[model samples]
Target: MASATFRATDAEIANPERGMYVWAADDLAAWTQAQADAQFAAGYRIVYTPVRLDRYAGEALPRKQLDALNESFATARRAGLKLIPRFIYNYPGGETGYQAAQDAPLERVLGHIGQLTPVLKENADVIAYLQAGFVGAWGEWHTSSNNLTLPAARTRIRDALLAALPADRFLQLRYPPYLMAWALQAPRWRDGSGASRIGVHNDCFLASSTDVGTYSEDAATRRRERDYVAALSAVAPFGGETCNPADAVDPTPRGDCDDILREGRQFGLTYLNDTYYRKLFHTRWEAQGCLADVKRLMGYRFELKALRHSPAVAAGQSGDLTLTLRNSGWARAFNPRGVHMLLKHRFTGAVVRITVASIDPRSWLPGTTSESSARFAVPAGTLTGAYDVLLALPDGAGSLAGDVRYSVRPANADDAVRAQGWDGMLGAFRTGTTLNVL
Candidate 1:
């Protein structure tokens, strides 16, 4: 994991340069489209979709929802985001708003579980984690007269939900104040291992004494919140932090979007998600502010080792290869668009050939990353033993392609998981010891 050393004070994620998730609206198309803009922006790289949970429970989720998830994922990928599902515990309508905290029925609210069970099982690839420490004003506040309060009872139910979730995933804790005084102790989790992945989600922007738009811009307010999160790193380890007012509204702002990120660095925050408000959802230009933030932070230095490919025993009509694509360097590589490397074959002469499909890498991690790969068959036959493999942009940009050292042989039965195809563009087949087919 990139964030293995991320202690209480570090940004608790593996790769913060691009580990950005956005809390989007309920509308699938709009959310996906908005994420594209967020991707173009510098900061928001990972996208948490469908802000409204009602549609997820009552509508799009009930259908074979994979296609919508695909479209949203595709949108995020195109916009350069690693897609993540932001699970909500309760839907908006039907006794959601204005209800007394004590009077609300836990089971009825918890009933959303049955609805989310299948969704999580099916879409865990893009799913980030369930959103907690939230309520009416959209799960962003703490200790207000707001909608959801982090009572022990509700948090226990949340722990149950996480128990039912799959492997290598995490939980994003939105409001950390209540978390420290009341939330974290509700559940116990030993983290970063396959059986015990646990984490937190925090942000510096919040409600204000002035206008909501003016919240983070306040001189005294931004500093206090920044220090508050920095302080939390000492106790509550935040895996992610989503800072808003990602905008630059001048007026002598002490720490703007850039500052929120620097805090993530100081506090050992691993994953960083961005929240886009309702008013600015429609504009592409508004998103560039986010894009710049991401680029600035992604400048971490890493030591890189080339991937080693398999030797060709025989060249048949079809086959595949798996290489030890090691991160020789200490740093990790994260995809801004989520699809980073493209494989290409150099033919005898100047004629170059490329893989029919692109390579979809696993979770953006650091140090000797294991790369699983697959390719198809050759129609006829050719001079086979050892062939050259080149790495570069997906489109073969001469200006962008990296070194050529990796090679591929054949794929084994243990490879290929239908579930793996759910996230990025995952469909490149490797035949047997021979050439590749479809």
Candidate 2:
């Protein structure tokens, strides 16, 4: 049992693989057979979210995608697993004929929710939410959304949803700063209407348009998820960073579990999954294909409340720089389970020196995010090339992420040069350094 009085329900744990990346399937049988074989070999259950009809098929609620997805659901159930049929809406392409009818009454939205719920109810696992700013999220690779302009329509749709969804059904609003603000002032529904489970999911790990790429947790994405959770939580109870699964990535994975776990707990989110579209293929060797890396990121976000650390550095120095760390995660090291934060350096190809910390593989659960510090001394003879600090966390009673770098040549850090390095040939392989766990 979770320590919290308001822990997540059984539905949230539909399947607990820690991370998920998906493959497309014109035929569900083919995907199921392939995935089953892979899962057995991986020694882990794989979380596969089928492509919603809103994507590739052009059917906002296309029967075919649903049918194909149902097949996958059937397979998952048989294998003792779960499948979330992702439904992305409000995108220009997803603008169904029915949307125009929503209007102030939101009748169209209600009818649509009403229409789809029944089709999915029998497959209770099909229970899920919507992508509020669906097509507009750069995180989703369909970033042309600013041009697509989902706009304020999400509120209306959300209103209709209040009356349509069941008590436990959830809907994730993609990066809606505006909605977050509005949600703060208003509840998900007017009260007597039905309870709507709402939250935020971001493509923090995603990097490209139709590309399965991602970036490490920076201040902005953190701010967004934090803000969204802050806002959405006012109306609902949970939220999370919908990260992508990664195998190989630059800057490596780091300090994210702090944010991930922080937001999960703070926002009432006990369960987390990737954006339905934020994924790379197992065969994909691109920097975006960080499934292995993303694995280190599952289930760590608790509830981050603006706890930030500032480094005391000036020039290129070998001194230990300490930044203020916070307990934004769900659990503390003192708990039955402990969460630990690690820092590492991307030293050479296929090699990363686990400089400051290591992965504590033994503890971690689906709803634990602990707070800790990241301290590392610049190597005595470190040169002036480029370097990064990584943070690794995971899902457990304690923490489940691994070593993540936090800084490089701290004292000499430059705004312009660092800016150049920012979004640079990112998604590329950095030097290989391995951090042996403690």
Candidate 3:
């Protein structure tokens, strides 16, 4: 009849598929395992790599280039880091502005996507989500020398990318209107269709009144667009980076802690670019005393508030365990993951695992507390002994199911939880309580 309560930690967690992500070198091949290790050591679990295809705009990607791309995924897998990959043709600016930025024609773009589909599917384990790129300047989908910005062109590109990516994965566009134009249904994508999997990534976050044209300038239109993005973000991933304050439309000196936190919560912001406009925004947040908060609350910070379980149970009998958790982050996990309950024998090292099928971590929204219960049955052959209780939220990909680096850890205070409570080898959190099997 004993229950244990756990305290939450304010420290930042380097959980998989979320938080501030640094940019890798332009060449995916240049993303070495050493670089991944360093980033993970620096408390980063995600890396953003822009795959440049400007040279192959008129033709198919060479075998060497494709091999390099595959190598990047391998590196990520070895280092236990996920990637936010974007395939773009050109950056903004030349003799002309974005208008002169030369992206591939519609046919060529689709061809490139078709070529990249296999790589994407093969590496979906390491890919957090694919950004909708390969159009306009800097892959923001604005200007296109090939008229890829036209309504029909955009539709074709969107559909092609969605088709290319794994159905479980999401594709994030640069603007809100792109999603609104296509997804007329509700925000939640339970149907697993292409439209349901589409989300928004605002590259120009907090840069202006409308985030540098991410939303409409018209009052009525802007309201509707923001509403759509907010609703969509509840179920899909929503993230981006801060643009230069100089580019702000109002230019009233944004990036204050209050405004940043307000908008972050409003849009359910998840991952953000840690490299871009750092001095203007990140540094300011640090000085203003909200940088750590932003880092800790970006994606999904689950805290174990309490645990209830039977102190002892007979072999072959079932015992109920319940957990009270709070998602203190700005957004929930958009991708699917596995929830499990484990009983590790203290003496023999034998483990018993039960999949908690009733709970989905993705549905654990920010600023909300949820209680999930599961029943675990002891094997008839189990030895009568004390067994440690553990909880695991691991990646859904079969390839990553055993990797602790891809698992979710509760943001519980180190002092309140057992020392080394997070078992790297088992990829589970020790509940600081043991069960006796009679």
Candidate 4:
């Protein structure tokens, strides 16, 4: 029997589906794999792309545009990045040639959703989540010339987006009241039902006391909305970026580290825009010495603390392995992932994989410590040799099951752990503990 304890590392990890994301507003037809690779090389694993549908406001999306959209997904997959995609009908100065912004009517919007459903389904593996867009200016669900923000119209759009998205994915709403209002009527949202798949994204985060109308202006109502968002974020995704601080209503220390970190933890923020509102992230946070913390703590950061296992076992016998870890980030993983243990023969290169079904990474909440153990059997007729042990946390999607790009790597600081622990090819972590099979 041997046991070892490890310490946490402060270095930034380029984990998937979390951290700061670069905003890509260019047409997907022009997106290049080289651009995506550059972003990934700079330590970003996610990109926030707005799919503008203004040209097709009155008609369905053409096959050419659909293929271009699919190519964007292929680019992300090739570059090892995920996307926070939003399909929008209009931008501020779009080619609609109207004084006021205009979005399609409810019927046309529904038709567009039907046309985009298949593409969304096919590339769902690379889509981190879809934003509930397609209304008003900038697809923010406000000030629609067609009055799409009206309760009846908004409900129809929400339902259609949910139905169009893949079942395993989440749809982020622009406003908190939309989610709160729906939860009141459905009640199932309080539990982990279909409603749980809906989450919140605030583009004007920390721009005011209420995030510039993202939350209620009324104090009591705002409290309730924040509470609900906190609860929903426990099981879903909550992320966004700061708007222009100069335009803030209550401009007193809004984007400071104290305010940002407090709200980040409360909302369980998963991702943020690295390119937007540089005053806060680039200047203020940098001068205040919290930019690094914000970068490392935005999403889930799992760090292994200790491990204990049987040092030797015989063929057809069982061996015990236990690991203690802590989630040191602001949020847990919102999507489903699998935990696995692998044993590889030192000379023969034969590997045995055992799934540790007892633990789910989504339940590993921020700032909490948890332990998981597995008793695996040494298969009959196994080679008698020293085997290297490893840990893997892989995406649950069948298409991405063995891809290391979608897997999670622990933040451990030991020299051996830092140097030899990560198996980028295998998407697993070497435990530094070997088991001898007799």
Which one is best on lDDT? 3
RMSD of each: 12.4, 18.5, 2.2, 2.8
Worst 10 residues of 3 by lDDT: 413-422
By TM-score, who's the top model here? 3
State how far residue 44 of model 2 sits from its true place (Å). Answer: 5.0
Q: Residue 13 CA error for candidate 2 (Å)?
A: 12
Residue pairs in candidate 4 whose N, alpha carbon or C atoms collide under 3 angstroms: none
lDDT of 4 at 112: 90
lDDT of 4 by residue, 1-438 (tens): 757677678988889899999975555556788898998889899899988888899887899988999999999988888999988776675434433777898899999988899999899988998988888888888888788989999999888888887777899989888887777632332264667888889887877778877878788998888888887888678898877645445554377778778888888899999877877554688888888888899889999888888999898998887888999999988777988877888999988776777778887889899887778677888889998888899987778877888999898764664333778778888877788889
Better of 3 and 4 by lDDT: 3
**Over the stretch 1-438, how does candidate 3's per-residue lDDT look in tens digits?**
436778787888889989999987775656778888898889889898889898999898999888989988998898889999999888764424776788988999998999999999999989998999898888889877888889999999998888887788999998888777777654565566676787889887887778878888898999889888888888788988887656556755467899889988988888999988787788999999999999999989999888888899999898888889999999989888998878899999899876777778887879999998777677787788998888899999989988888999889875543532677788888887888999
Model 2, poorest ten-residue lDDT window? Answer: 403-412
lDDT of 2 by residue, 112-159 (tens): 456565555555442334333223322232343233324455555555
Write candidate 1's Cα lDDT for 28-92 as tens digits: 54674654675546445455554345333323334444455556655553453444455442333
Against the unseen true structure, what C-alpha lDDT does each candidate score?
Answer: 0.38, 0.35, 0.85, 0.83
Q: What is the clash count for each candidate, in the order shown?
A: 52, 60, 0, 0
lDDT, candidate 3, equals: 0.85
lDDT of 4: 0.83
For model 1, what is the C-alpha lDDT against the true structure? 0.38
Off by over 4 Å in 3: 93-97, 313-317, 416-420
